[model samples]
Target: MYVTFVGHVIEWRGPAPFYFVRVPEDECAGIQEVASAATYGWGVIPVSARIGEIDFSTSLFPKDGGYLLPIKNAVRKPQNLSAGDEVTVEMTVRL
Candidate 1:
């Protein structure tokens, strides 16, 4: 399943801060339908995603009944993405 949407980058402070793009509620509904087929385990969904021409593979984390798309540094640096930035994501769920 493939999906595209715009989301705001958010920062989560842990031992180290992390960045993510929270998937919108509307998009979550569609992803839920295919969640079972795509999730490897722990309700986390595997996906190939692109941001500003940088492509990477990561797992969507379940949060607040929705999903958080982790934006890794490898993909962030080149794109100059950071917290509070609005970004367009092209993602594909591998079933």
Candidate 2:
């Protein structure tokens, strides 16, 4: 099954490098696991993942405060993404 989400590229900071797309405040519940962590050795850790295709709209903010990009359903190899390129990601949710 495939789902669709609309958000903006917020940032990219992961062990394997993932996009941080921000969903709107009202639609935030549609996505889950939106949390942050502060590790003493690893520094700040942002937790975000979701199911289905994530479509980043053209309207994006210049600041790095958008919703977290959903990497859970990434279809293509996650390493192929960049910092600022808006994309429509397709993926399968792992069970």
Candidate 3:
């Protein structure tokens, strides 16, 4: 499944800090409908994601009844992205 959405980059402070984009509610609902088929354990859905010209593979993390798409540092530096910057993400789910 292919989906695209614009979201802001946000920082999550866990054991280590990380950046992510929260999937919009409507889009999250759409993913949830097919999540059982696509998700591994813990509701993680594998997907190939692209932001600007950067492409990478990662899992959508379930949080607060939604999903957070991790934005890798490698993708961020070249793109000059930081927390609070709005980014458009294209994702292809591997079912």
Tell me, by lDDT, which candidate is best.
3
| Residue 60 shift from truth in candidate 1, angstroms | 0.2
What local distance difference test score does each model get?
0.93, 0.37, 0.94
Q: Candidate 2, residues 47-95: lDDT per residue as tens digits?
A: 3233233332221222233334344325324545444545544322222
Model 2 poorest 10 in a row by lDDT: 34-43
Across residues 1-94, which tens digit of lDDT does each residue of candidate 3 receive?
8899999999989999899999999889889988999998998999999999999999999999999999999999899999999999999888
Give candidate 2 regions above 4 Å deviation. 1-3, 14-16, 29-67, 72-79, 89-95
Candidate 2, residue 17: how far the Cα is off, in Å: 3.6
Question: Worst ten-residue run, lDDT, model 3?
Answer: 26-35
Best model number under TM-score: 1
Candidate 2 at residue 33, lDDT? 34
Model 1's C-alpha root-mean-square deviation from the true structure amounts to: 0.7
Instruction: Give the TM-score of each candidate.
Output: 0.96, 0.32, 0.95
Candidate 1's error at 18, in angstroms? Answer: 0.7
Clashes of each: 0, 5, 0
RMSD of each: 0.7, 9.3, 0.8
